[model samples]
Each structure stands twice: as structure tokens, then as C-alpha cells.
Target: MSKNLVEVRGLKKYFPLGDGNILKAVDDVSFTIREGETFGLVGESGCGKTTVGRTITRLYTATDGQILFDGKDVTHLNKKDSKALAKDMQMIFQDPYASLDPRMTVEMIISEGMKIHKMYSEEETRNRVYELLELVGLNKEHATRYPHEFSGGQRQRVGIARALAVNPRFIVCDEPISALDVSVQAQVVNLLKKLQKEKHLSYLFIAHDLSLVKYLSDRIGVMYMGSLVEVTEAEELYKNPLHPYTRALLSAIPVADPKEENERHRIVLSGEPSNPINTLAECKFYSRCPHKAECCKAGLPALREVKKGHFLACSNADALYVDNQGFL
Candidate 1:
């Protein structure tokens, strides 16, 4: 087995409101991404998936918990070490247009990281910029153009090129294809897969699209409210989802075949997601879970392995099984 390139343990990022309330954007989340593997994080909007990615890249400081990168304790890196960490870790933002500076040329945007890290000389940086652009499917001539000149797909290619500039070992892909057209989304996903194979890069991919996540991820983690509810291999997750939220999510993925799609039962979950502000120690999905038992209300279940290579946080698996038989 490949060694873990990144390990996040009990990670938490809480935002303080003006009042006494505290919003737990990420609460006690933990996972590991092996070298050259893609770990996909999926959930509904406002589920703290984005916050986990940002915190891992150090764009946002953590409220508590530890982050280890390549066996180094990176949770509290000094200035010098932090600068070194920048070269090893990188992020691709969701908004391709907003992430790239309008005033800068494509060449400038792609070579910025290399120049900051002093990775190459000026001539080398320029040559590397052209190479990266080509690697991401853009040509050398486009380097002189500004962000406004490119289409959404082209702009996203530029963003991908920029992320690759430093030759990072790991990247946080924060919904890199969410804003693109359906045709373009596949192209970007393929590009990422191609790059990962060529460069041996690990990814922490965060997205709401479950089908896309399954296609690209080696393993998957399902998040809800502020915590991870289930984690397992990508295929195993779709084949056997133990958590109620996971079942609901998988059931909602649109089937490609019209006949099958029409025939399949959809698990329509009711009620809004629970508020994250100072929530009590109880199952957050209690409001919408059809399998909820009195035991679920006692305290928040800690994520533990239920079977080989599968981890779950739900305590009422029997109840889930009972409901699965006829609840759909």
C-alpha cells in the first residue's frame, strides 16, 4: 500500500458570530489521502466541505486539531517551514474567473508560484509557463492574453496550469469544474486524472456531484452538517452505504438510463439540515433520518470502522437496515 501523503486528525474550524454563538464549519473531521490517490469529499451545500479544504491548504487557520503532511507536523509550521509547505501543497479555487487576476496575463498567473518559490530563473519560468499551459491543453500564444479573453473552460485550464506551476505533491481541488459547462466539466476532470497519473499527485477533491466524485475518486468521504458521516472506497460506498445520509445521497444520483431512472426509488429526505451553531452532542441527521432510534439522541457517534476498510458514524445500523427494506 502507498504511504499516506496527508493526514488530518480531529480537524475543526469554527467561525464566531457577532453574538455569543459559534458556527462549527468543521468539527472533528479526520481522514488520510495516500500518495497519488484522490480522496473525494461530498455533501450538500453549507456542509463544511469547502472549509475542510481551505483549512488543509492554510488559507484559513484551524480552530483546533492537527494536520500532518508527509510525516511532518504542519499544524503549526514556522514562517520558513510554511513557505516550504507552499511549494508542496496548493489549491484550485472553485471560481475560475475570480481566482485568476483580470489584470495579469496567463503567463504571469501561471509563473507566479514558481517565482515566489524561486524554483527557476526568469527564462526557465517563462519556458515552464508555456509547458504548463500546453500540459493543461492551452497553447503558448495564449500566455500573453488576459483572463477576460478566454471562455470559462479556457479560464479553468489556466487555473489548473497555475496550480501545477509549483509541482505540488498534493492539491486541494475545490469544485474545480462546478462552474463549467457539462461538456467542459468532463474535459477538466480528465485533465486532472491525466495530470495525477503523470505527476503522481494526491488530491483532496471537494464537490457536491456524487457521480463525478465516484468516477474520479479512489475513496470517498460523506460529510453532513459539520462532520464526516461515512468513509470507504468509492465503489464500496455506492454498493453498500451504511449511513442514512449516504443512502439518501446515493439514491438521488440521476441514472443515465431513462427506464432505470424512472423505475428506481428515490430516498427523498425531509426537513432542513440542522444548524451548526453550538449544536448539542447528538446525531445531527436525526431530524431527517428515517432510521433514527432513541440511542441516536444520547450523544454524537464517533466515526469507527464497522467492517474492513469502511468507517461509519451512525450507531443504528440495524434500524437503518429495518427501514431500508420497506422505507423506500
Candidate 2:
């Protein structure tokens, strides 16, 4: 098995509402991203998927728990240490347009990391910027242009180049393709795959699109209201989703075959969503889970392995209790 490049244990990120309330962004989330593997995190908006990625890359200070990167505890690093850590870990923001500074040209944006870490001299940095531009499918001529000159897809490629500038081993892809057009999404995804294979990079790919996640991820983690409900190998997750939220998420993916689409049963969840503000120590999906029982309110269901390599968090222990035509 490949060694883990990133290990997040019992990670928590809470934001204060200033009214004696706390917004539990990430609550005790734990997972690992192996070297050269893509760990996809899929969830509805406000489920804390982005926060988890940010916390892992040290963009956000973790409220609690440990973040281990390459066997070192990086949960809380000082400014100097954090700057050093940046070369090993980086992030590709969701919005390519907003992520890049309009005042700077593409060359400046891509070479910023190299300059920050003083990884190379000015001449070497310029050559590296041109090299990275070509690596990301852009030309050397475009280096002088600003971000606004390119389309969404082109700008995203620039973002990818920027992330790779420092030769990071692990990257947090915070919905990198969500803002792009449908036609261009595939191009960006393919570029990422190529880069991963060439560089042996690990990724924590956070997204709301289950289909895209399925296509790109080695393992998939389903998050619900600041907690992971199901985790398994990509194909295995689609083949057998143990958690109710996972099933619902899988069912929501539109099918290409009209017959299969028509016949497939959709798991429409009922009931109000659980409040994230200082939530009780219980299942977050309890409010909207169709398979939820009275026993679900007893206590928080910790994420535990049900079968080999397949983990789930549900109070209902009956593994055979699959619904909606065995989740189609």
C-alpha cells in the first residue's frame, strides 16, 4: 500500500457567530490522502468540505485535532515554519479569476511562489515560469498577459501552474472545476491527472459533483453537515453506499441512458437539515435521514469500518437494511 502523504485526525474548525454561538464548520473529520492518490470529498454546500481542504493546507487554523503531513504534525506551525511548509503543500482555489491578482501578469503569478521561498534566482524563476506555462498547456507569449485576458478554463490552467510552481507534493483542490464551463471541465481534470502521474502528487479534491468525483478520485468520502458519513474506494462507493446520505448523493447523479434514468429510483430525503451552530453530540444527518430511527438520537455515530476499507457513520447497525431498491 502507498504511504499516506496527509493524515487529518479528529480535525475541527469552528467559527464564532459573536452571539455566544459557534458555527461548527468541520467537526471531528478524519481521513488520509496517500502519496499519488486523489481523495475526493463530496458534499452539499455548507457541509464544510472546503473548510477541511483549507485546514489541511494550513490556510485556516484548525480549532482542534491533528494535521499530519508526511509524518510531521502541521496542525499549528509558526510563520517561518509555515512558509517552509508551503513548498510541500499548496492549494488551487475554486475561483480562478479571484485567486489571481489582476495587477500582476501570468509570469508574476506563477513565479510568486518560487520568489517567496527563494527557491531560484531571478533568471531561473523566469525560465521556470515559461516552463510551467507550457506544462499547463499555455504558451510563453501569454506570460505577459493578465488573468482577465484568458477564459475561465485558461485561467484555471494558470492556477494549476501557480500551484505547481513550488513543486508541492500535496495539493488541496478546492472545487477547482466547479466554476468552469461543462466543456472545459474535462480538459482541466485531464490536465490534473497528467500532472499527478508525472509528479506523483497527492490531492484532497473537494467538490459538490459526485459524477466528477467518481471519475477523478481513488477514494470517495461523503460529507454531511460537517462530518463524513461514508468513505470507500471510488468504484466500491458507487457499488455499495452504506450511509443514507451517500445513497442520496449517488442517486442524484443524472444518468446518460434514458431507460436507466427513467427506471432508477431517487432517494429524496425529507425533514429539516440539522443546525451547525453548536450542534448536539449526535448524528448530523438525523434530521434528514430516511433510514434514521429513534436509536439515532442516542449518541453520535463515530465513523467506523463496516467492511474492509469501507467506513460508515450511522446509528442503525443493520448493514443489510439497504433501501430504495438497494440504492439502485
lDDT of each: 0.92, 0.90
lDDT value, residue 205 of candidate 2: 93
Q: Provide the lowest-lDDT 10-residue window in model 1.
A: 319-328
Runs with alpha carbons beyond 4 Å of true place in candidate 1: 322-328
Task: Please give, for residues 233-271, the per-residue lDDT of candidate 2 as tens digits.
Answer: 999898888888888888878899999999999988776
lDDT of 1 by residue, 26-49 (tens): 999999999999999999999999
TM-score: which candidate is best? 1
Index of the highest-lDDT prediction:
1
Off by over 4 Å in 2: 322-328
Backbone clash count, each prediction separately: 0, 0
lDDT of 2 at 28: 94
**TM match of model 2 to true structure:** 0.96
* Per-candidate TM-score against the hidden true structure: 0.97, 0.96
